[model samples]
Target: MRQKSVLVVGAGLSGAVIARILAIRGVHVCVVEGRNHVAGNCHTVRDQHTGVMVHAYGPHIFHTDDAEVWRFVNRYANFKQFKNQVKAQVGGGVYALPINLHTINQFFGKTFDPNAARAFIQAQTTPVIAPARNFEEQALQTIGRDLYQAFFKGYTEKQWGRAARDLPASLLKRLPLRFDYNDDYFSHRYQGIPEAGYTDMVARMLDHALIEVQLGVRFDRVDARGFDHVFYSGAVDGYFGHSYGRLAYRTLDFETRSYEGDFQGCAVMNYPSADVAYTRITEHKYFAPWESHERTICYTEFSRDCGIGDIPFYPIRLVHEKQMLAKYRDLAAREAGVSFVGRLGTYRYLDMDVTIKEAMQIARTYAKKAGVAALPAALEAAA
Candidate 1:
């Protein structure tokens, strides 16, 4: 009997997990990646000069509340404890991010306890804008104008290349201000980076007899004719040759600098001041604190409008983008023998853990039913 064959597009976490699960279930899988190597954005390589693991695209810290997702990643590679402690570079002073107790006290020059701090911040907020209209208004009503201007206003404008009032109120969905001193960026139960690197971990995930990985190969809809089913993790617009107008995205431009000693004394230092063109500076060596290096590499990240031939990073799912995304999704639903998966496919900003979890679920559903016909929302939503 001929074994069922499946095509997995884009060798990132989503494709890697799906390929592994389906292969384990007795299906033959072919993974094709346009880039010369696998692991897409999460691709990591050791700097020959510094011997430091560099996050080729940007920093990806695996932090998740889901126990299953944590265990799943651990199976591929050993993970080191990595807490993302971020600092913000403002006017003549540095402050802790997420606006915690220390940041509040430092910025205001007041020593207030947690209870007093909460009350003080509450006092600062004015009820001028009821049912806030946009990000700027929502922020002023929640964190007060003083802190909003200092922390969010300029940074938000620089990052999105737009004024705060122009952005959706949903962008600042929750009050980012914290009354406590917990400096950890993410509050998830599991947080860490792979000891070897994400690329190594993903490589292990694709290491199976049933899985065949071909790098530097781009697969189009025509190529789907050779396989029973296709799992595409590439941009939804790219899959259809971008028939509908292109969706808006903010791509990052990194200015890398090599230094003999520590540069910023931290992994990520954000510049909230609009005067500074770049958003943040990330020291790569700090990402893996467990490993020490004499030389360090830092990337000064600049966010701007994504252009042709540029790698899209953040999907700007504003009003216009959302409307355009609907048209692409409608086209995706009509396509046969193919399912769109992952951040680019769904047109949403997704964390690494969520990407892996969704991919695993999709593959498991297919394994249980022994056919793509039984796939879940990841497929049915488009259908």
Candidate 2:
């Protein structure tokens, strides 16, 4: 019998994890990435001038509640305990994010206990008897007008390039409103960043003898002829050449600057006010607190509509996009010997852990059997 050879498209977390798993099972894996380097958007490198590890695409903190996923990443590289304590600069005062007890007290200038804070927030709500109609309604119903305006309204608008009312109510459902002092942005049990950097970790994952990674090489559907099967992690729409139409996605533009000392004093500081064109500023040095760096590098993040030839970040699954996604999914279903995986392939925003977990699952399934199946609703909701 001929050796089972698979072509893995894109060398991001999803592709790397999948490639590693398949290689362990004695499968010949070929990973083709359009970018010159591995790790995709999570690519990290040290600044020659400042000696700070910079998150090339944007700030990506590895956070997950899954124990297996945590162990899997730790196998590759050491991760330091890192908490994403985000701050928002709004209305002349800077406050902690996720609207914790500290934020509530600071914003309203009142010191209240958990129960009292909860009651106060409840009282501030608009008292909508029906379910929330939109993102704005959801915010007003959960945190009330005052807190919503200060923290979410302008920032959400700037990030999505749409009015809060125009966005779906489900968008605000994930945002936690805590009555306690806990200000950690994510509620995950395991949250940290790799000590060596994401690129090093991904490089270790792709280090298997059976795996061959081709950087700066673009692979299309036609190129899957030689391999027995193909695992595609690129844009699903692009796979089919956007026959239906280009799916809507929000891309980020980062303006990086070198600072002599601490710039924002935090990993991420959000500018919620509408006056600010950029949404947030991220200081790279804070991501790895274990390391000492005298100088710092910061990035000012700006969110905008993804144009042609732009790197798509967040998939905007509004009504039109959903319809277009369904059409592309149907096309994928008809296609043979190919499986779509990861954020771009599924057209959803996925965290690092979820991406690795799904990749492992898909790879294991494929290794056990010759036929590989696509992940259905792996991390976040698709389409």
Clashes of 2: 0
| Alpha-carbon runs more than 4 Å astray in model 1 | 371-383
Steric clash pairs (candidate 1):
none
In the order shown, what is each candidate's alpha-carbon RMSD? 4.0, 4.4
Could you say which candidate leads in TM-score?
A: 2
- TM-scores of the models, in the given order? 0.95, 0.96
Where does candidate 2 stray beyond 4 Å? 371-383
lDDT of 1 by residue, 1-383 (tens): 56889999999999999998788667899999999988999999998989999999998899999987887789888999999889998889999988899999999999999999989988988786468889998887788888999989998998899889999788886436688999888888999999999999999999999999999998877889878889999999998888888998999999999999899999999998888999899899998988899999999999999998999998988888899899999999998878899998898888999999899888877666655334353442221
- In candidate 2, where is summed lDDT lowest over 10 consecutive residues? 374-383
Model 1 earns a TM-score of: 0.95
lDDT of 2 by residue, 104-183 (tens): 99999999999999999999998989999899999989999999999999999999999999999999998899989899
Show pairs that collide, candidate 2. Answer: none
